[model samples]
Target chain A: MEKNNNHDRFFRELLSDSSREMPFSDFEDEVMAEIRMEYEKKFSGRRNIRLSWLFFILGMLSGIATVFVMSFYSANQPFAFISDNLLPVGIVFICLTIILFAEKLVKISFRRDNH
Target chain B: MDELYIKKVLDGDIDAFRYFVHQYKDKAYNLAFSVLKNEFDARDAVQEAYIIAFRKLGKFRGRSKFSTWFFRIVINEALKSSKKAGKEKYIADTRTESVDPGHVEINDIVSRDQQKYYIDLAMQNIPSKEALALTLFYIEEYSVEEIREITGWTESNTKVLLHRARKSMYHELNVLLSTEKKTLY
Candidate 1:
C-alpha cells in the first residue's frame, strides 16, 4: 500500500509539472478555416434553393403571359384547337413548377441531414 | 469569457470562435496527447475535435462549462484516432524498449527526465479509459465529479477506474524497476 501511494504521488507530480503548451501554433486558424468552409457550404446550399425557386416562378409567369398573348392573337383559330394544345402546355408548366418546388424541398432536407 | 465567444459565434461572427480555440487548445492537446501517445496523432485528433465542436456549437446548452463539454469531445476524438491508428502495437513496442537503468546512475539531471519517461510509459501500459481518468485527475486536478461529467461515466465507475489506474500504474513501475534491478545484480 505504501508503495502504491508513493507511485501515485510520483507519477502525479511528474504529470502535473509537465508543460501544457499547445504544439501547433496555427491550431486556431485551422479550426476557424474549417468553420468558414462549413458556413460557406451551408450558405451555398441555401442560395441554390433560392435560385431554383426564382427560376421556377419566372418560368411560370412567362408561360402564363404567352398563353394570354396567343389567345388574343389567335381569335381566328377554333377555341377547341387552342384549348387542346394550350391546355396540355399549361398542365406541363404546372407539373414542372410543382416538380421544381419538390426538388428544392428534397435538396433542403438532404442538406439538413448531411449537416 | 467562453460564453461571450459562444454568443458571438451564434450571432454569425466566426472570428469569435478563435478566442475559444485559443483558450482550450493546450488543455485539449494535453488530454489528447495523454490518450493517443503520439504527438502527430494527438494533433490530428485535436483538430478533428475542434471542428466537431464548432459544427455542434449550437447544441451546447450551457448547463456545463464549455470547457467540460469541449474536453469530452476531445477525448472521444482522441480515442477514435487511437483506434484507427492501431495503437496497441505501439504500446507493446514501448514496453519492449529495454531500459537498462542499472548501467546509468540516477542524478539530478537524469532522474527528472527518466522519471517522466517511465511514468508516461507506465500510463500507456494500462487500459486507455483508466489512463484517461488518471490524466484528468493528476494533470488537470479534476474532481471525481468533474471526471464523471467529462467522461460520461457514472460516479462510482469513475472512482473505480481511478483506483484501478493507480494500482496498475504502481504495478507497472514495480515491473520496470525490478527489471532494472535484475540487470544490476
Candidate 2:
C-alpha cells in the first residue's frame, strides 16, 4: 500500500539493478575481499551496527525474562506484593522505554523544525 | 561475513587481502556499469571506489546498512569518474547489439516513449550530475530521501532536482521520440 504507483514500480526495478552483482571473475572477488578487510580494521574503533544489534538482542532477551519472572511473582504472591519483583520490573520497563526513546533523539533531525 | 578469511586477515595475514580482491572486484565493476553506463569507466570507477571505501572504512559507523554505505561510495566514485571523462556519449547503432523483444531501446532511458532510442542517447551528453540524478531516481529507483543521502542534497533539494531532472529528461526524450513516432513510425 505504501508504494503502489508506476514510479514505485519503476524505482523497484531500478533498485534491483543498482545492486553490485556482476559476472564471476577473479577481480570481483579481490575487490570485495579487499574492501571488507580494509573496513574491518578501520571499523574497529566503533561498535558497528552488527555488534550493536547483538547487544540490543541480548537486552531484549533479558527484559523479556525479567518481565516473565516478575509477572509470575505478581500473580502468585498477590498478598506479599512488596516481595514480588513487580516493582523492579515496572521500573526497568519505564527506564528502558525512556532510554530507547532517547536513542531516537538524533533521528528527529528529519522532522521539520517548525521554529 | 567472510568469516575464516576475515579472521586470518585480522590476524595480520597479507594473503587474505588477495582473497578479498578475489571476492568483490566484479561486483564493484557492475555497480559502476549501472551508473556510468560505460564498461571501461565502470571498471576503473569500481576499482577507485573500492580504494576510497577501503581508506575510509574506519569512518563508516554502520549508521546505515553495509551495502548501502558501500553503494554510496561507489556512486560517488562513478560521479567523479563521469566528471573526469566528461559527458558520456550514447550510440543507437543497430549493429548487432542485444535487445529483448518489445523493449524499445531509447538512447536515453528517461525519455517518455520507448520509441526513439536517440533521445536517451542525447541525455548521456548532458551534465553527468543531472544525468545521474535522473538515472538514480527513475532507473535506480532510489527514494527521494535515499537520493538525498546519496547525492548529499536536502529532502527539498532532492525533490526539486528530481522534478527538474524528470522534466528535462522528458523534454529531451520527447524531442527525439515524439516527432519521429508521429511522422516516421
Interface RMSD over true interface Cα atoms for each candidate: 3.1, 9.9
At residue B114, what lDDT does model 2 achieve?
Answer: 41
lDDT of 2 by residue, B42-119 (tens): 777777676675565445565775456766788788877766776444433322232221233243344334432453
> What would the per-residue lDDT of candidate 2 be over residues A1-67, giving only the tens digit for each residue?
4323544444334333334445435555556566666556545623443465566667666766776
TM-score of only chain B in every candidate structure: 0.83, 0.62
Best by TM-score: 1
Against the reference, the lDDT scores of all candidates come to 0.75, 0.56
TM-score (chain A only) of candidate 2: 0.37
lDDT tens per residue, model 1, B1-185: 88989999878898888888888888898888878877778888888898888788888899999999999999999888778877743233233333233222223333676766767777777777777888898888898899989989999998787776666666677676567667767
- Fnat scores for every prediction: 0.54, 0.32
